[model samples]
Target: MTSFQMPNSADQINLREWLDEQSRQLGFDGLRITDTHLGDASERLNQWLAEGRHGQMEYMARHAQLRSDPGLLVPGTVRVICVTMNYLSPVIDFDQEWQRLAEPTHAVVSMYARGRDYHKVMRNRLQEFALLIEKQIGSFGYRVFTDSAPLMEVELARKAGLGWRGKHTLLLNRESGSTFFLGEILVDVPLPIDQEEESHCGTCQSCIDICPTQAITAPYQLDARRCISYLTIENPDAIPVEFRRAIGNRVYGCDDCQLICPWNKFAQRTALPDFAERHGLGRASLLQLWSWTEDEFEKRHEGSAIRRIGYQRWRRNLAVAMGNALADEAVSEVDKDELREVLRNALPTSDEMVVEHIEWALDS
Candidate 1:
């Protein structure tokens, strides 16, 4: 870790400069300051929610005001210190990941969820960064947020110039791409704000074109209802039949958009081992993950983001993937038969949701 020395004159050592140094030492890739105003992002959010684009994530609609304005989220906030952390595991090769996604029997968990829960990782680091800022500048009013709060993290980060919002509606940078986690520190103290970055998406629509479910409705617009990530992780309802085949072998979240993005070629690997693959998630087979008992699922995913969905959702997602595998021409008839037999065996003991999905997969 690099040590940052504050200048002998306290006045000469700007808080932002000190914060930047501390952030680097703390393993954050990018940091920028922005004001409380969220501008048109608030209106766009309202429109999206009004259209029911958030799907079953009702919490998004509940905190509209707080999410749009940092001042409202954290009273007396004058600046937002947005931070970005690249989480692309060095162990992963994009080409290999896409190849694995193609395999009917392989379980494709999203890259970001392969390790520790980012909510915990980012929050802990942000809290530490905040405390460090206070030690340097004396007592200060602030709040740290990862994805835990009803905050518009990507919008805040975009405004802060950590990166620009990609067409897939994720933060993208020339150096780190969209394979990063975003966090924010809403502060009362005014700080030097960064200029917003210009969008570099240009004419490329690979993210939109490559979506298995066509979740990206248009350039810069996403319909979360059709998103595989939302279908597998957020929506507690039955996996929509329309998207079952497209869901393929993705047992958790989907990364097709990010994986398809040209900018992702430049995505940086994570500095923290916290983002490394665990429980062989990056290469686990669908049958392997599906065979875990509820207790085993709980024990294995104790510190992982995938655990949040619970064993029931986990089973439901895997069942959907298995169904897709059954229908895939790439999978042999013998493999399909085995998958069908597995689904049938689980039907007698599975929950109503899981049973329905299992039956669907078997029939698919």
Candidate 2:
């Protein structure tokens, strides 16, 4: 527990302006404040969970109440100071991303996970921002979060006017598109709230239309069970055979929804070196990633978000993609033969789960 030295009303008025400037200096692309009432979003979350749309993510159901109310998660919370940091690196071109997706042998990791783990990068910076706020006023009751807690980050960010939720259900800013990480500071102070942005997605169903697995059931709704991001990263069990063909060569999280979004043309590139592509993840092929030993995977993905998925899941995803490549007529016989040989070589040593996926790849 902590105490607060409340700022004078005049000081409170100027604090918002100061925060905006300081956040920009600290590499935050956008910052906004909002009250902690999440009535509709909470209800929607409960309904989504009831439908089992969250898939194997049992945490979502366990923390439903806490996620609905930040004050419950962090006592004394009155306002949420939401911040956005663009993660799209300058080297990423949307056209190139489409080209990579078309290439059956090329591995496509999500744009966000190609760099350093955002959970660490954003949380550290959020703590600094919170400390700066404390310095400006005095002892302040607050807690910083960046996808660490059970709270509804995207909903809070949407209320704070960081951006409107797109049809794809990702926060979308006209200036930054949907290529940013969200963080928040839960504070006891009653910061002036920003107005919510109106939905600008008029009738754009491009995201729903482009989903390889039809994960987006409707505008503003996503069924995570069908989502490649969930299958590749969150699902601990076998990658279901039905979606394996659709998974294509995505060895990690999927970015199809964002890539097809028209507004993403305005997606801003990040200046932070922390988000620069690592280990050539943005362009690595299925064969290249499949070559990594468990030790190599651990060593290469050190300090990366991808490492959290562990080596077993990593191999599972790669094997699925390699199987998809084997089925592709576009892939050369030479590459397909090599993929089959690699799958066969790993059969004896792989765990049962991985061996099943590897055998599936061989059968393809």
My TM-score estimates for the predictions, one after another, are 0.95, 0.98
Clashing pairs in 2: none
- lDDT, candidate 2, 1-364, per-residue tens: 4465557779777877899999999999999999999979899999999999999899999999999999999999999999999999999999999899899999999999999999999999999999998888777789999999999999999999988999889999899889999999999987778999988888889999999999999988999999999999999999999999999989999998999888988999999999999999999988899899999999999999999999999999999999989999999999889989988999999999999999898888
Per-residue lDDT of model 1, residues 1-364, tens digit only: 1133334545544665777789999989999889878889999999999999999899999999889887887788888999988888889999999899878899999999998999899999999998888787677788899998888988888888888888899989998899889888888876667899999999999999999999999988999999999999998979889998889899899999998899988999987999999999999888899889999999999888888899899999999999889888989988888888888889889999999998888777
For model 2, what is the C-alpha lDDT against the true structure? Answer: 0.92
Cα-based lDDT at residue 88, candidate 2: 94
Worst 10 residues of 1 by lDDT: 1-10
The parts of candidate 2 lying over 4 Å away from their true place are: 1-10
Q: What lDDT score belongs to each candidate, Candidate 1 first?
A: 0.88, 0.92
Error of 2 at 241 (Å): 0.7
